[model samples]
Target: MGRHSLPDQYGAGASDPRRRARRRTVAIATVLVLAVAGGTAAAVRGGLLSFGSSCQDDPVRLTLAASPDLAPALESAAKRAREADLTSDGRCVAVTVSAREPYKVTDTLLAGKDPGAEVWVPDSEVWLQRLTATGGTADVSTVGHVASTPVGVAMEPTVAKSLGWPEKTYGWLELAGAALRDNSLRLGAADPARSATGLLALTRLSTAAAGVEGGDTQAAAMMKALSQRISDSDGQVLDTLPRDSSGTEQGNPRRNQALVVSEQAAYAYNTAADGDRSLDFFYPKDGSPRLDYPYALLEQTGLTTDQSRAAIRFMSYLDDPPQRRLLERHGFRTSDDEVPDALVAGAGGSGPQPYAEPAARPASAVALQETLGVWTITVQSARITTVVDASASMSEPVPGSGRSRMDVTKAALQRALATFTAEDEIGLWDFSTKLDGAKDYRVLVPTERLGDRKGTGTQRDRLSAAFGDLAPVPNGATGLYDTTLAAYRAATGSYAEGKFNALVILTDGRNEDPGSVSRADLVAQLERLTNPERPVPLIMIAVGPDADREEANRIAEATGGSGHEVSDPSQIQSVILKAIVEAASRDGQG
Candidate 1:
């Protein structure tokens, strides 16, 4: 259940069906045995299918997909439920728990399919927001948290002693920045794009860093450093910690003296480790974000009424005294307002440390999007080709702001450009009728690394100048269809693997050029150019009232892309970031 749980083991191999059948039979047997003291052994010892069994055969069997960290505890709880003869409406209830990655499960649920589970227990509420944000047709409802764990810096005891852990306190920014400068403390974290713990911790760190004078630079520097040691998931981050007392694994560069991990993870490690361990933790003075394990029901699929009731019944059963004890033993807080002394101490905390402080505020969708965008640019750098419309409609000024759509959009783009690092590859293009003699689009910059050398300066410099120079043609008509096809073709040709590859189109109107390719032909060409092995998701931003959002969405979907609307072009960067985060997630998960 902890690290032993595999990511994609839900509904595993040929034995899955057999396992379910066995569980049904065992459920019936367990109910029958409760009627008599020795019927269980008597029936099993005799190898009896049934000894004049009068057992009413209806049973509620449910599959619960839970985060790997909580699966072991839930499995134990399920076994206890069965032993107690727990039932819903006179039918014996049984639950089969499968360990799964929350991100992958969220992707599956949003795709409007059964994720091989009737109920899902993801590690945080953020996953719910992510699932619902897509406007998914599936009806997955939250049933509240089963357990929780706070995220903080977990360090080896020696390192903690040097930092005055038990006596002195530190904020996220202070500790994280100090780690960046000090060579002794090798800091590591899970990729924020994937792990909630990482994202929450990074958000807190970012917030703290921003309050200072030179915050932007500091935050970017810290993220770049952390990326060198970032793990794909929370469990893998645990793997990066030092295993022995010496704490000197010179051969392994991945080994870390400190990490950003949840209290439950620290507790798990401390329980198994020797005296010298990474149990020493520092709960920052500012605040720590908690992973609230929400028990959500996947009611969109084959969830029967009985199965739903049985799931609810099991949820209640988890609140029982024994179940509570089980959760406590595994180092989880059932309530957010209350802090468990034993659990915190086990994860290495003391009275002076601000362990009981109120948690950090819950992150909003916008904050999450912006933070993830920062990651995509700085650490998980992307390959983006931005195509802007130069039609005459774009020349009109925005209602509230005096600036034209092109002006606000260019400023927003330049700001966005600063977020990206040298590792990122970006290109620029502008389009309208007769913009490139006969062609509808003209490439302002070729797709290449921002770090690469251009004429005098770098690619980033060339891109910045191009963005500033963008202007709308006086009498030009929209050539959106042709531009989309051309940009997508070039983007696919210059695809960079292991990066968030994308084509961004900013337009104020639909295709108005009679010579342009038909929408159907453009979509087909985009679809053909979109390689599953090397995907290039086109992000189309309809910048003003005149743009056709439906058409943008239709074309974007053909290349596994997304469409967004920006009444105020000032919000384009935020929209692009959110879209990029979604696209990157799909790329990794697929």
Candidate 2:
């Protein structure tokens, strides 16, 4: 206002035409220049005019989710990178690290949900494999490894001494036998389905058990025994240890005897104990699974070029010599060929040495899936009603096998029963044309608790006997629709609390009985009967090439389950187990 004030004393100039014209032109020019300058200043204030029309000073923000145990080192490295003025291209970067459990993160991704992270640092590559198996949308690539650790048992020094720790060698079977034989030696482990270390331990146990005669039976029994000592998380499992007592050879007898965890975790715990050496890790002599901490870049749809560059920069920073040393200090091996001296000392070793015996072989995805299936069965007891088709078609011999389809199926079912625990409740039914006088299905065995055997033998024995006695009626027709509807209704009506309630239907042909319900009506009724809060999954195992797999799938889909088709009855065991696993995975889903 002071510079552009119109002269109040210019009355004469206003009256003079030429003089007024000249003053007006000059004032207009000045007003235009002022307006331009003000607009430029406002743009600068709004961060729209920085770096010559490019806002390069603004830091690109990146979010990284890392496993809870490894998050501290990642955060420290992030802070150091920021202090060092790490940038992406010509722009500054800001990274925020969050601690999240690997399993929870995997579940979120598998549910077709984004975790709002541009980078993820899972404790093992197994999670990525699982994600891929589940058809997750997140495209991830491993940039590099941050640290390495192996799965092993962490035990009290006293227990180790009793077991002849450094002087004696022990494998999974030896440890499992000790736990089974001695109730006083309380062994605890994390849930295998939820923890990589737990999964590795369980796989090792399964592999060891599979080598012996009657392996599946022995494995199931051993797993059931160990299930009693399982905890929800690794930290919880370690918490079972006795409180430290200064200068004592033996810990409190009340504490847990041993726990399955990663070598790094055990080292961290011992380090936190201030060199008291109360706990030490025991690498099973047979072998162990190793965790290679992979830094994965999650390329989400919304991720920008700048963010991607920033993630790469941060990943590279983690692999640098300085940050690698930081990882070593946290009780992790930074290299594959050589163990760091600090990690060796932290793990209670005198000199550099291998963490654990080299793994016999990496666990395959299929093997892992099967292991998870077994674990699911062991952890939760199922209430199942099995319906078998006794049509004439079932009497046909399986291709390349001398046994009839019915015989093969019955044998498979008998074997499958061994995987179930004593608490699981099971029933048997056979369906054909007019099997129960007016009814299409007949109950061969009443549903009862497997462990109960008051009048007869145990439920397992009764079920086995009934299965062996099953014979397809001559000239019988399939009653697929009516029997499925009736079985589903019965299972739902008698659904038990705190257990998976479901129907296991094995069929070899389509509905051939004219008096049975129509397929459309059955599917519609099933859809209407489905309740998300109280699920009664219908797992259909379709055997032989003639089985109506499409109808089976439709019915199962309506009730939040799945259908598995086995072209050969001899392969029914695998198909049945797969169906159980799929149903378990969809337990909480609608």
- Please report, in order, the local distance difference test score of every candidate based on alpha carbons: 0.83, 0.76
Query: Highest lDDT among the candidates is held by which one?
Result: 1
Q: Could you say which candidate leads in TM-score?
A: 1
Give the per-residue lDDT of model 1 (tens digit) for 122-141: 99887888776666676887
452, model 2: CA deviation in Å?
Answer: 2.7
* Model 2 TM-score relative to the real fold: 0.82
Residue 390 of model 2, lDDT score = 93
- In candidate 1, clashing pairs total 0
| lDDT by residue (tens digit), candidate 2, 129-246 | 8887655676887767777787877776677778776667678888777766767677888888778888878888878887888677777777777788887777778787766555
Ten contiguous residues with the weakest lDDT in model 1: 1-10
Please state the error at residue 44 of candidate 1 in Å. 26
What is the Å distance of residue 115 in model 2 from its true position? 0.6
For each candidate in turn, the TM-score is 0.83, 0.82
